[model samples]
Target: MTLEQLRALVSVVDHGGFRAASEALHKSQSAISIAIKNLEEELRVEIFEREGYRPLLTDHGKVLVQKARTVLSQARDLSDLAQHYAQGVEAELRIVVSEVFDIQEVLRALRIIRDQYPSTRLTLFVENFSAPLEILEDKEADIAMVAGGEMFDKIEMTRYEKLCPVSLIPVVSGCSREQKDASELTKEDLHGATQVVVTDRSRNRDERKYGILETSVPWRVNDFLTKKQIILSGLGWGRVPLHMIGDELASGDLVPLSSSDFGPVEIETYISRTTNHPFGPVAEAFWNLIIQRDYEKTNKITVKLQ
Candidate 1:
């Protein structure tokens, strides 16, 4: 019933005996036993079987102990949240990223954030197309890294920076009928071919489709990875990020299928915050980390050019 009683119950289960629980909690063994007894009486369940040298948890005790651990974790999180606010640190940082952007860079930035601010909860939503922007506009995300296109022009961002350019290559499985020895295939050749495309995760279904052939049969998927898998399985042909299909391209498992209308599509990706909402200390630090990484990358490219 009480947190102390729950703590005592969990401690006994974790440390394996009444005396050990007392030692761990810095309480007397009798006090620990009394706490457990009170908890068991209140719940009207036998918590422990005191038959062996070490007390064994009853079936009811095991279930209650798991629940107790969850309660204790949430209690600690509440305490941490209070402390974070007192220190001007954000309790949570949510980032909506497009799947086209390199995940390694995002993972590296997250690792640094995790090390620097352990208490700040980080939530990352990897979406395709205009979904990241939709989440940002809805105020569900703090920052978004999305691919730039006509849909991107509609948003007015409070903060914006170009991240990188991603190239989406039109490809098909080597085993597919569309695969030919010629360097290029015409639009007529792929008129009826099934094209796997990632569906926008946004509420706005009217968003214009990019790099899609109007005549091709459409097969919609939720993510680029799934789209790539479908194409690899010879189920369909579609455009995927060049970085994602590098190995498959090299192995000839996936063959590039370029036409007048279908070829490599270069998309400029950007990281931006739409709202003017003031960022907490942790969010500011994370934003700076991303900017710094971009700066370093630019400098490296500039140095090579020099």
Candidate 2:
């Protein structure tokens, strides 16, 4: 009936006995027992079978405990939301990052943010293709690190900062049957081979099959790392980010596959956020950090050019 009673019930169920629950809740054993007795009487149900060595929830008690947990969770969320508004700091910040973007830079930024805003919770979702954009549009993410292309133009962004262009090179395993140089291989040469592709994670969007040949059999994967591993095993050929496969290409573990039909694709990456919603303090700090980093990189490039 009350939050205290609910907490006492849940604690008793979780901690195994009245004594343990009292100890965990910092309440006397008598008080815990009294709370449970009052709750059972009010509900007109036996919450625990007294015959057992350890306290066990009765059938009805199990159902009530589940409901109590939901109520408790919602109550905590409400409290946190109030605290967030009062303090001007987000209770949680969600970021959806495209897998193609180098995660090392993002991780470093997050490490700094974690230390700066210890009260704000951070949730990172690594998705592929159009999923990051979709998540941002749906208000499921506070920010998105997406590869800018035609799909990115569809969304209206309040703030965005461009990063470096990512090069996607079509590659095959060095042990593959086709050993000719990349330029010598034609579209026809790769038509019969299996092409590994990362599936779009968006739910409703009509997925575009980039660089896929009509004649080639396509193998779909959810992430790029798996796709890269499949291509490295000689099971299939696929285009992966140059950053991810630099060592492999240098060591000749993976061979580049280019032809008149498909050679390499380049796309710009952006850190974007929508204007529909205002950012809390933590989110604002993170956005500023990303922009500062971009500015620093640009100044370095300009100095070198000068």
Top TM-score model: 2
How would you encode candidate 1's per-residue C-alpha lDDT over 1-306 as one tens digit per residue?
888998999889889899999999999999999999999899999989999999998898889899998798567556655755687877789999889987888889899999999998988999887788888875678888878655666766556778657889989898876677424887777788798998876765436667787898999989999999999898988889998999999998999875565678888888888544556777777788888897898799789999
Runs off by more than 4 Å, candidate 2 = 1-84, 152-159, 204-206, 259-261, 295-306
Model 2's C-alpha root-mean-square deviation from the true structure amounts to 9.2
TM-scores of all candidate predictions against the true structure = 0.65, 0.66
Winning model by lDDT: 2
lDDT of each: 0.82, 0.83
Worst 10 residues of 2 by lDDT: 201-210
Clashing pairs in 1: none
